[model samples]
Target: MSKLLVKLVVNALFTVPLLLYLSNATPFQALMASLSLSILAFFLGDQWILDEFGNAAATLADGLLAALFVGAMGTAYHWGLSWSALAVIAVVTAAVEFGYHLLLRRWDVRWYS
Candidate 1:
């Protein structure tokens, strides 16, 4: 699939359940956040990190960004803080992303080499 499609799929894969588990989360809020952050990641997290290092470093950076975004939802929604929730979202996202990036890494290495 194309990069854009992959991003959408990844965002959907992670974001939907996250919103579901958050309790009292609005789909609109979740969607807006995902839309904006996915764009942010496309630039700040993905392109920048990839240029600065490699896929592994980008993965780490993406995880951090994802974690922060997930953690911030409580604050954004005035639902107070939920550290455990944030940690779960971040870890799940990171694990999923790591696998995705591994595929990308293989393709990228082959494509580049």
Candidate 2:
């Protein structure tokens, strides 16, 4: 709950601005995309992959997932985000995810339970 909220806030802080600047998306669109991406990343990357595959693998998986997810959303929404721009967004988000995974490790939240 708290972890998910924090992740949402952090992801929105990074994603919304990037989407607005890079894709010329409206604030509502950017925020919706950010929220959707955050939920997907939290469940798949932070919850499952992080527990099963460890940090480095989880980070890489998260980055790839971010790229794919955002790319799909951009296309669907006609946001016109380029592959290179998507890469930049994924890299930045992955960097933050790396630190976030570390924090999750420290907190030892009952992700499964």
Kindly list the per-residue Cα lDDT of model 1 for residues 1-113, writing each as its tens digit: 37646876787678666866664567777777676666767687555776567677777777788778766765778644377776676767667666766666666664365
Candidate of highest TM-score: 2
Q: List the residue pairs that clash in candidate 1.
A: none
Give the distance in Å from residue 69's predicted Cα in candidate 1 to where it truly belongs: 2.0
lDDT of each: 0.68, 0.89
TM-score of each prediction: 0.78, 0.92
User: What is every candidate's alpha-carbon RMSD to the true fold?
Assistant: 2.5, 2.6
* lDDT minimum window of 10 residues, candidate 2: 104-113
What TM-score does candidate 1 reach?
A: 0.78
Candidate 1: C-alpha RMSD to true structure equals 2.5
Least accurate stretch of 10 residues (summed lDDT) in model 1?
Answer: 104-113
lDDT for model 1, please.
Answer: 0.68
* Clash counts for all predictions: 0, 0
Candidate 2 ranges beyond 4 A from true positions: 109-113
